[model samples]
Target: MRQHFFRCLKVKITKFIAAGMVVTCLFGSVSLGFAAPQPSPITILPIDRAKFVSGQLFDFLIEVKDADPDRIQVTVNGVTADKYFGKGAATDREASLATYRINNVAFKKPGKVEIAVKATGTAGLSTRTVKYDVVNPVAPKRAKNVILFVGDGMSLQARQMARILSQGITEGKYNDLLAMEKLSNTAIITTSGYDSLVTDSANSASAYATGHKAVVNAMGTYANSTADPFDDPNVENIVELVKRSRGMATGLVSTANITDATPAAMVAHTRKRAEQNFIAETMLDPRHRPDVILGGGSRHFLPLSTPGSKRTDNKNIIDEFKKLGYRFSGTKSELLATPPNTDKLLGLYQLDNMNVYLDREMLKNPKVLGGFDDQPTLMDMTQTAIDTLSKNPKGFFLMVEGASIDKQLHAMDWQRATYDTIELDKSIAIAKEFARKNKDTLIVVVADHAHGASITGTYHELDGKKGREAVRIYANAGWPTFADNDKDGFPDSPSPDITLAVQYANHPDYKEDYKFKAEPTVPAIMANNKAIANPQTSGEFYPGNIPSSDPSEVHSADDIILNADGPGADYFNGVMDNTEVFFGIVRALGLDGNRNVK
Candidate 1:
């Protein structure tokens, strides 16, 4: 049968090879052509196979390279694009690049939609076709509230380290599992974006927020040919969907700068996550503005005249939020004093990213914390957000992030990163307690991406073995003595006699002392435009494995773990794409985005 199948539908191999045609196997019919198909020069936004909730707004764009200025046609399904969108395209052309863009459009119905683009270029006619899926989740029992926890750079190892520190193991058995680990449903989540193998916090978080993949350094939008960051094709995120569809309150809480990549992705749409100043201003846009905002980036919200302000323009965003009836808080005391009736709250504790839990709370080092010592814990911030957002009968969607896990890992400070992971774990416990009282709440805990840190074994200088020699492996490795003496979940001391010997798989040239830094120090320093081991450690030097341009470790492409509880979490099972998280949240809330958009 196989011989007969190939013999009956055979192509002239010589003739097809003479042309640039590609031959098909027995399963496909052969097509003889002048050339094998080439990739289209025109690019469409939303990418191919994008999924969305019906009526979720997004910007559509067609970018053409080396094309004639006036020769471009776009169609949606079979209808002309402009007519289909009920508006004409805003065309822009510069040099060899031209674009046809339509902003703030949505599919009113649930089904598949095709976008076809054709442009006349010097290389002749260039055509492209892309399809999208629109869905409307009809739930049996809806969750009135949803809380997402992102532990940035928290890989499986990162989580395990937190577990070991917070809940010690005895004879190869853990005494207690983490609060997140106790979740009913869990999944191994793939964390790459469309453009890169390894993703940064912004791109991964954007996938979680918008149900669409974005490139590194970008969030809430797709990249376009133009250089403008804000003008990129925008996608409606979870924040916007919950707002217009269900009148749900929204909150974004983080330990990093409030306008940083992970937190900002929930609300801001930009091709560059570094646009912190603009992100701070975009929060004022009522169409998708969050009801509660908490974090450590007061600099971006302050006016340019303020000494530590990061904005170039003299825009006082904090004052603007005040005008909009938001009670402002700059310290833990102020946050705690916020009126219980205050539904709108804005808290920015530090001028920059907040210090890690270790440095801020336990170490009490004035040098590390500077003057901003009154910062709130992740648990307190999340509790405050839940309290304020729940005031709305419609419920809310809140995103809480442990921002320093990634930052400390980048600096190769495993001790600090592990403490932040514990902090995130404790915060998850708080959210779980809230969900217990309100059965209509869903809680999700996940990592934006993984770091390259790994545990070789335990390290100790007890036997006079020092540096690399002190690293114990196999039978010599004993359990780390990380005791939670006071029952606060955190180890009494991070520098136990036997401590985790965490090493980086991908790292810059750096010093290795087999000891935690008393104060956080850069693993590498720039010397003559190249990274070199820091001299502060006074230990053996290890050469960098990655490019010299990066003095810190980079994100790993490894799959991350996600745990969830309450309604609709069962949707997450087996191996899943990162974008599915957004769908899971929407499904749990029964958010119906199918509506008219004007």
Candidate 2:
């Protein structure tokens, strides 16, 4: 009887074990069907599916998070990348990120190409595939010369402001249009870089110079995963290309420093715009050097021994340029006296940025001029640049920039910004006159980016309604009483009885008095790294909208206007990207991307 009972118990235990096995199999299969967590997303510079000109150099980069460098595999067009490009890949490890780069690579053929990357580590595997389109079309009839005018942050509103002040309005009609308005071709230009929607002057100008979209604060080069500003992978700019392929003369002019972003984009390549001292030295490079360089920021050119010098080294760039057969000019008188036959010219007018038109040309205030008062006007500089560069029998490329338009707008000084716009218009007129005589020159006037200010009717204190209460909108806003009485195309005074109520779309914490400041004053000041309203002013206080990191107004992502005339101007008519400007210029000049280097 005991043996029979034990046998039954064993049978029960075996059945229970069988049931447990079945349950385990069912649940294990379900768990196995679940997917593992995905790895972090990869960052690819120039982005995926970016387009490029055939034989145009660019860096190909892949960044993987928490990945091992040895486990990373990069392939181009389904083959090993290093083998296909004939160059080995470079790896950089920063913290938990692994970055692989192939520098100075170009697609010689005109077609679609693919780049694939796979990275594996303790966090698992991450894969990314990017495609690029390369094109090399034969250009049409080309222009002998090209002149590009960049009114930094000059928006449609800024143009209108200039028109109202310079052209004068009568019975809802204007007496004349600005020279830029008289252009035959116009287009809305979108200014965004690879990194963000809003772009700074550096990358926006880079798009025009290199025909590639770069990140903010970078120009003529790709922003890489490195701390060194000068070591980024470089792309040849118009200055280098034209010099290399056709030996064309190149010139750059700006109201700001020569090493500033807009002008520097024409020749210099670096990840940071603040490296002005390095840029001052980089201008000495012969490969992409400009024949005519004129602007401000003389401090960067002076040696550390000089009292006002901003350079940390003892090298004096001015003396260095003088040794290179360049006729150096330190003041407007010197620049005007520079012989027209001079092949190379370098002009530095101020220790920092040159004063705006209202102060330098009209007011001539000694305090405002800061002893560097002999700065040349934009028109004067434009004429001088054209006169000097036109001596090139092989033709020339000149970039004239009205940089202070953006600078004044950042300070929320609409009146000063308007005057600078007028200054830019006058310079454009000079270019137009040059173009009329030499029809072979393609002239393009564009803005690097747009400002936030707009005309919201008019404001007046005649009714004793001061400040915000004085603002008039729609029908109540009659024509502004700005009069160019001397026919000089500039309002005698910025603060007239009645004026345009220019409103800002975005701003930091600031005071708004609905009146102009006599001196160029900042709207906000820095306090503990936060943008705070200027305590010195009394007006309606506005809470800040932008981050505290910025102490002034910022750029907008709004589409800017581009006006063009002369040869190849027809290429610009519809909505276009900023990169298209470079292509247009290249097409107009018939630049060959694949020209064999000697």
Candidate 3:
């Protein structure tokens, strides 16, 4: 009975197999009766033109399609990777995708870098080869200290206007040139970032300090697929590289908040410039901390319960710096009294942005000064910073920023802006005097961006008429009597009988009273997060011409002029990328890969 049952089961199985095969043949389908082999599915795009200096750190990325991360293989310059990317790579197993990010890798010898990547999966195989050309940088010859001066939001027109106002142009040529104009070399720098033609202060300054282009509002890091702002990969900054390699002192001085974009770019690496609290702490980090930090924004350093603190914790950065042997000063008298030989000096004079020159040192306007009665002048701050940093025997790198020029210009306060420009010139004059004495110091003056300001002749209110009808032009555009008999280098008052009737080429369609504002007026305000014409101004109602999203005057996508003096100045001429400024400064300081590489 058992034998009979076995025979019956075998006969049924044979019948079912034959029936299925006949059905497959009838449908014109055949099965191979074997599993298919997997194929590679990884590729790398060739870098036809990769611009980098020897020993410069850059990234290499690999993309694998339809493959597990564990199945991917990568080789650098034909070397068998023992450990790809140190440990491993990130992968999406269900999606059959993987990404390998290699950081701080560079070709020390100048040549072509060939990268090969292979990926295999159950579907198929893919392979890609990429070549990147590595060129050596020009070796340094004779310069030591490099000083970079940035005039925020200054443009060619701003420079021309400063020349006309300060040196007085009579019949086309009657006065001397401004100090910046007399530089040994001049270059027109293109200020666009990797993201847009128009760049903010942060990214542009980062490009100048680190020879890599970054996106708008980002500093020292590239935009990547990450939710955390601090986790993005970073490029080495001049402050870190110089101090680590040469043991040189680095100082950052600005009239704006110390945590503002331009100054903050030197040390902090973050995707967002508004991360003031994080940036302040980064400034205190021993590895990236600056030797001499003199500027405003003390509120971010103190904790919340400390009355005027802007921070959430009780870190007391002031106390931390004191513990670190930094001479902390909260007032001008303390700054002046501090001994010149002090190694590390940290000065924070105000809880916010220090008052501008017209308000703090000159006008003494209480409404504008806002009870922060005593603040250091640009001159005072520059002198103290120089005295402190110059003590380093290995030399120092100093970045001085004249910040409020753009702030006042955005408010349409031409007089205040001009005064701030004069103040910047004074600071440059001080740097030049120092550079003259110390021939090794390479000094550079440039602007991170430009504005829409122009000299459309001059404006005089003498016509007894108001608005555009009173605007002066041509021979009728007689010069206004702005006497500086005291030669203090500033007009006693901007409200003369004939004042500059400067009209903004692009602004909200508002009535023009053609008079100087006694107090700085808010040109625009925020309504539901959109920029609307400020109702605070005393004028006829005007609708805005720019996008409602913009709060005030926006940065123009115009090229800025750069002036340099000392050893490596010749490299900066005609049209050049903003990153070239970094290369020039590094060459001036003789920064070498062998010297700085760790």
Candidate 4:
């Protein structure tokens, strides 16, 4: 009876072990059966599953929630990260959040690299793996100089509108192509950043300045957990790289404020682009500052004691730059009068953004100019920048921006935007002329983003059918009657009898007047935190399809065109990410970021 009872007990024990194995096979692991829910997955910067250029510097960061630093293990390609990088990461703890940072790390060779992190604590065990492709590029014959022209929001439609209005069309065929259209090489550039489908100027320009994608409103820096804009992890921009590695002269010229996104991305390292005052001060840093800085935003350069100052502090940046031997110009006349031999220049034509071509030069509207009427044209600024930057025996990198194209388009003023596009083309002509002479200057013309505007048909008031009713489409849509009788690149008058019916693909609740305002005007105004049609115009009211939070038309995710000429221009062919612009420029300049300079 005792032997039989022992035999039954052994069989029961064996069955129990078999049942446990079945449960382990059904579930993930034996430990997981008794363990609590896994901890939240780790977050890493430079992200996982992305491609990086070999020798490009970026910050390595990791965040694990509710995990002890001692319990975390990070490895790169099965080896400890500290051993792979030859340096350990710095750790910081705040309550349940633990942060690990390894700054300015780069992959020297080309290959696939995997970063794995495992964290174990009371919560549970969590793991994450990030993969990166480090690319090795071949050296090319370098160009002596590179000129990048950003026609802010200059879309294909914008280009066509400029071509029609400036060059005129007769019998559906005609005169000539714009300078940008005549470039030797072209590419379709995708402008989306890592954070979103559509990108702002700051992040878009950041891609070209630094060969890394950034979040919107951020430039040359990765957005961090801190509230301080300047405290983010920085990726060295083209200005810094060129200056530090090659001792190249740099110039930034724009119709917008010098502290604005496009130009500021070339130097400033901040997560927030709207930090105008801080950006103004950062422009004085000798490490990355440009040799020629021309545009507006004098308000930020003035001290708090000054009448039109925008800065909160008593620091007078204009005075500081003057002390550093910068020749400052405050007007068109002053800019022209600046000596040709002046090595350094700081020109601020207005307290805010310099007026657009239509308002400042063509119309000369006092209301829009606001006592600052003598702003120089974008062409003037570009020519001046080129002249000053060329004085250096070493080659220079100049970024010229036609900023008001985006600004006017946001206001739903297509005519003004088209004029600015023409202005950009003229500036491109200037750069092409310079490139022709130098033979070694690489000139790239591209847009940061695209507006939601397109040319649908033609509008005519001859029949007296007003607004939307007068919009003639298809076979009925005749050619526009824009004329350039004076031989100037601009149309004689913006408001012709038969003009192009430009429409916005996306807009706020606004009136569609289908006519150009004599002065600059906003399409929608804020009321009760919502966008409402401006009562200033009379037309058919259309409700917005976009969110009410937006006061104007927003940028589109559509790809923009990039045109290039001169040496190394062949690299710009087929589709490319905006970050590739930086690589192209680097290849043209043969920049060695690891090189040391005095």
Spell out the clash pairs found in candidate 2: none
Tens-place lDDT per residue, model 2, 539-597, is 88988788888989999999999999988898998899999898888878876677744
Angstrom error of the Cα, residue 270, model 1: value is 1.0
- Model 3: per-residue lDDT, tens digit, 437-540? 98888889999988877766666656576566677888877776665667766667666777665656445434446567777776777889887767666654
lDDT of 2: 0.88
lDDT of 3: 0.75
Please report, in order, the local distance difference test score of every candidate based on alpha carbons: 0.90, 0.88, 0.75, 0.87
Looking at model 1, residue 450 earns an lDDT score of 96
Highest-scoring model, lDDT: 1
Q: Can you tell me which runs of candidate 4 are displaced by over 4 Å?
A: 1-40, 49-54, 77-79, 135-139
Tell me each candidate's TM-score.
Answer: 0.94, 0.90, 0.85, 0.91
Question: After TM-score superposition, what is the CA distance of residue 68 in candidate 4 from its true location, in Å?
Answer: 1.7
After superposition, which runs of candidate 1 have C-alpha atoms over 4 Å from their true positions? 1-37, 596-598
- Model 4: lDDT of residue 281: 95
Worst 10 residues of 4 by lDDT: 23-32
Clashes of 1: 0
* Candidate 1 similarity to native, TM-score: 0.94
- Cα displacement (angstroms), candidate 2, residue 352, comes to 0.7
